[model samples]
Each structure stands twice: as structure tokens, then as C-alpha cells.
Target: MGTNVTVSLKALLLAGLVVIALAVAYLVGDSRGTPAEAASGGGETGSSAKRSVTVGGTGEVTAVPDQLGFSLEVRIIRPDLQDSLDESGAAMDRVLAELADHGVTEKDVRTTGLSTEPIYDRSRNAPTTLRGYRVVQRAQVLVPKLEDGGAAIAAAVRSGGTAVRVDGIALSVADPEALLAEAREAAVDEARAKAEEYAAAGGQELGEVLTLREVSPTYAGEESWSEASLSRSYASDMALPIQAGEQELAVQVEVVWRLAD
Candidate 1:
């Protein structure tokens, strides 16, 4: 009976050990499957880690201006401020009326600058009293038809609008925003091409676009197109014929791409 009892106890213990071993094996197998399932599932794959490289460059395109700007200024000088103002007003009215007759609407005619100053004779050392006042009024005209710019100015001057000035002439896109968008896309393409070139030449992958900038374009008409460039010259040198040349609008950009390993 003692032997039989010992034998039964040993059998029970062995069965428990077997159950524990089987549980451990099942747990191990389940845990190992999780990593394999995750790898094959919605998680990012190693192929996505391939590095992309980029380079940078700049490009510029020049075009002529299709529009011209005109400034018709009328100046009157007299010993009396009111007198000069009256004379100037009459001349300005005639000039503006003439412009309107030529299809220049009120919307197109914009007041640019005006001034009234006491005329002083500073030739002598002694301070001279105000002899008269000089009154001047100016308005700007933007002509979509550049060929008509000079003709318009001539008409204004002949209409008694003296001291006409050509403020500036510029070239621009009909839709500047659209032009800028196109230019930006071109710049990005150029940058990407550069990156690919670098990569082909044994560089690492492209990381990110670190910096990007677009340069402001200026109208460089005959010379540089500043607001004062043409007018100041025309005032000092009126001999130049009125010829509204083509204007240009431009956009520039710079991009920097980080290098990846």
C-alpha cells in the first residue's frame, strides 16, 4: 500500500509538470507571432526608408513691358497763391477733360502729388520776401497700350498742362499672382533636379527643404525701373523722345535642402 501511494503521488506531480510545460510553449509561440504579424501589417515598411536627395539652382526670364505710365503735371507760378492756384486749376481742368475725351476714365486718372510753395529769390544775401507762390498738381496715367503713352503726354502738354513727367514704365504680367505661382513651381522643380543630380553623383539622400525664398521683382525698363528713375531723367533731360518701351516683370527664388544619410 505504501509503494502504491508513493507511485500515485509521483504520477500526479508529473502531470502537473507536463501541463506547465505545454502552457509555456503555447505562450512563447503566441508572443513570437505578434512581431511577425505587425511587420507584415499596416506598419511602415523598410522600403520607405530609402533616402531622397535634392539640389538647387536659379533661373531668370526677361520680357518686355506691355504697359506704360504717364504723369501729366501742370505748374503755375505767380506773385499770389490764389492767382497761381486759379491758373493751375484751369490748366488742370483742361488737361483732365482732354484725357477724359481720349477715353481715360476718372478711375484711370489718379492724383499723384501736389504742392504749393512760396517762391523766394535766394540770389541775394539779404532775405527776400515772398514774391509769389508756385502751385503744382500732378496726376498719373497707366496705359495698358504702351504705344499710346508718348502720344498721351504730348496731348496733355499741348492742352496747357506744362512740365509733364514720365514717372516710370514697367513690364508686368496681366495676372501677377499667377505668374508668381508658376515661377515658384519652376523653382521647386529646379531644386529637385539639383538634388537628384547630387544623389546620382554619390551624395546621400535629401532630408527636407530647410529654407525657401522668393525675390521681389523690379521693372527695369530702359534702365532700372524705380519710381523715380525715368521721371527724374526725363525732367533733367527732356530731349529724349517719348517712346514707351517694353517692360519686364521678374521673380527669383532660392531653396536649400538638407542632406540625409
Candidate 2:
């Protein structure tokens, strides 16, 4: 009887201790909360924790073009392929010499095209008869000084005679590093201004910039003069009249800012 009573008492004490330990564990867990709750800042929502605004701005810089590009071609046809090639080559040589004398460097003159093709007769009575051979030589010249572009072109045409064809003339900015930097600064300033305005409208303070990215820039007024237009505008004896007009470079940027309370 006595041994059974002692065994019962020991079992009751062990069960009581386990219940007290479980109650303590429950109290501690309730105070600390779950891992998910802690990660969510104890009840803060995602939207309230992170607030931001994105804006885009554009900036443009204009300056006169300082460089000129010329696309020149020399074409000739003859009864023999060798004769056609020789004539085309000689005309191109004379044009290149004239360009060099007019301050164009050797490196700036590049041969872009050289071809010899057989001319075909398309008469209804004959079946694609070979009439003659046509040879073409083309070069691109870069004139550093925009003012000398007309003189250089005229000299080349005079030396190459009627065989020389002025395909195109393009004007561009030779060095745009400083211009690009200034444009970028202006773009960022515009973006920040927009962000601040938006923040004020939303009744929030503008915080630090979270992200910034530059989009592809836009260039305006880089016109290419066509061959037909050139011929119509200028006479054979006169130098080609070129105007170095203003060109604009634009930069666009996207900025993201975190909104503060």
C-alpha cells in the first residue's frame, strides 16, 4: 500500500512540472511573436515601409556643327572592262589629290566602294546582250573645317570632271564629350526637380535617390544633302555653298526616389 501511494505522488509531481514548463514556453512565445510577424516589422505593411516615385526628364544642348562628311563616287563605262576600270581609277586619283591639297588628310580619305559590272542591253529584239562594262570608284572624305567643305568639294569636282558624283554631304559635331556631360547634368537636375514636386504634391518629403538611368539620347538637325539637291542648287563653275547650322543633342534620364514621412 505504501509503495503504491509514493509512486502516485511521484507521477503527480512530474505531470505538474510538465504543465508549468508548457505555460512558461507559451508566455515566452507570445511575447516574441512568430518569425513571419518579426520580419513584417511586427505589423507594418509593405506599402507603408517602402514608398517611392519615378520620374523622367529631358535636356538639350545646341551648338554649331564643326565637321563635314563627303561621299564622292566616280563611275565610267567603256567597250572593254580594263579601259573602264582605268578611267574610273584615274578620275578617283585626281579627286583624292584635290581633296588632299584642300587640307584633307590621307587617313580621312577612305575608299568605300570599288566595282566593275557588265552593262546589259534590254532591247526586246535581243536577249540580254552585253553592251559594255561599267566601273565605279567611291570614297568618303572627312573635312575637319566646316568652312572649307564647299571649296574642297568644288576642287574635287573640277579635277574629276563630269565623272565625279557628289553623293552626299553630312554635317556633325566633331567632339561631343563636354556637351554630353553638360546635358547629363541638366537632365539629372530636371529629374530631381520633378521628383521634388511630386513628393510635395503627395504630402511627403523627398528622400535619397534610389536609382537613376540614362535613356538613349536624341540628336536633331544633322541633315544630309542629297546629290540631286546639290546639283540643282549649285552651278558647275561655282563652289558648293555649305551652311554650318546649329545641331541639338538631347539627353533623357529616369530617376527613382524614396519618399520620406
Candidate 3:
């Protein structure tokens, strides 16, 4: 009987040991997470251990415009539609010839608008009456020679006579690459200065650049001609005065630098 009791106690102790081992194994597996969680980066990967600073910089360049753009129109009103068209066509031909003589190439002149509409004379008490047929022909002109812009406009007006209408003119830079390069250099220099100041304030140093990117530039304050400011009738023989004023071009950039130890 004593031997049997001892054997039974050993069996029970072995069973209890097996149970404790299984419980410990299950707890460890649960703490380690599931298979799916392990595949999808469940734990702290510590990828963002490196510190960096991002800063934005801006630069501007003021340059004189080198190109001129303007529009001209010829309008004639007559009792007959054919007469209106013929008169306006002849006036436009004169204007084009004058422009060609002044250095405007054929490619630089484009017929933008042409129409013939009936003119209505409206009164407060009377019914609207058809006055005449109005014909209009418009052309967009670009002059590469900035100095001769006023002369070209005056010649065109003189050739077209009193029927000619001069619209607003806008000045622009023909090639902006050189100015853009200068502005970009300025922007990068400004960014570096800002980064250095920030690094000093943080009690650290700037390391090599991690990333450099250019932001799309916005030219809001740049000066340009407005229709309301320059649009008018051209009936006089006096020369039109043109000024190729300075315009502002801007560039912006975003830069990231790693923090040094």
C-alpha cells in the first residue's frame, strides 16, 4: 500500500507540472501578438529615430519687361452689311500693313475677332429701331522691340484712321530663365541662413540636406497693365507713350536638413 500511494502522488505531480508548462507557453504566445499583426508591423519599428528640420524660403527678382502685347480693333457702321464689312476690312488691312512695316512679323499678328451685328437705337419711350450694321475686326499684336512699341501703335492708329480702337497693353519678360536662376539661388541662400539660426537656437548643428524641393511660385504683386487703365479710343495723330516698367518675379522653396550630433 505505501508503494502504491507514492506512485499515485508522483503521477499527480507530473500532471500538474505539464499543466503549468502549457499555461506559461500560452501567455508568452499571446504577449508576442498574432501572425497577422507581426506581418503588418505591429510593434514599435523605431523608423523615425533621426531628427530633422523643415523650413521654407522665398526670393524675389525685379526685372524690366522686354516684350509688348496689345490688341487693336476696327469698327465701321453702315446701312448695308456688305459696306460695313468692306470698310472695316480695308481699315484692318491698312493697320496690318503699317504693323508689318514697323517690324511686326506675320506670325506675331493674329486675327482674334470678327463679327457683323445690327445696331439698335433704343429710347426710353419708343420701340428699338435698327440703326445700321456694325462690323468689327480685331487683331492681337506682339512687338519684340520694346523701344518701338509706341511708334508701332501710333502708326497703326494713323493708318486705320478714326475707326481704329487701341485696347490695353501688357508688358512681360520674353525669357525668364536667367531671372529664375538668380531667384532660386537667393531662395536657397535664405533657407540655409534660416536653418543655421534655428540649429543654433536648438543647441545643435545642421547636417547634410535630407531633401530639397521647389514650391510653385505665385506672382501676385507683380505690376501689369489693366484694361481699365489703358483701354481707350485712338482718334488723334499724336504718338502713344509706352513704358516698359519693372516687374517682380518670385520663387519659393522647401528644404529639410538632418540634425547633427
lDDT of 1 at 96: 73
Off by over 4 Å in 1: 1-56, 122-129, 161-173, 207-211, 222-248
The TM-score leader among the candidates is 2
Error of 3 at 5 (Å): 33
**Candidate 1 residue lDDT tens string, 82-102:** 899899889888877765655
Ranking by TM-score: 2, 3, 1
Order of quality (lDDT): 2, 3, 1
Please give, for residues 115-231, the per-residue lDDT of candidate 2 as tens digits: 989998898887887889999988899988888888888887778767888866788888987898889999999999999999999899999999999998877765566666556
| Per-model TM values vs. the true structure | 0.61, 0.76, 0.69
Evaluation by lDDT, superior candidate among 1 and 2: 2
Residue lDDT tens for model 3, 162-249: 7887765777787888988899999999999999999999888899999999987644332344332232324454546677767888
Candidate lDDT values, in order: 0.63, 0.84, 0.80
Ten-residue region with minimum lDDT total, candidate 1 = 47-56
Greater-TM-score candidate between 1 and 3:
3
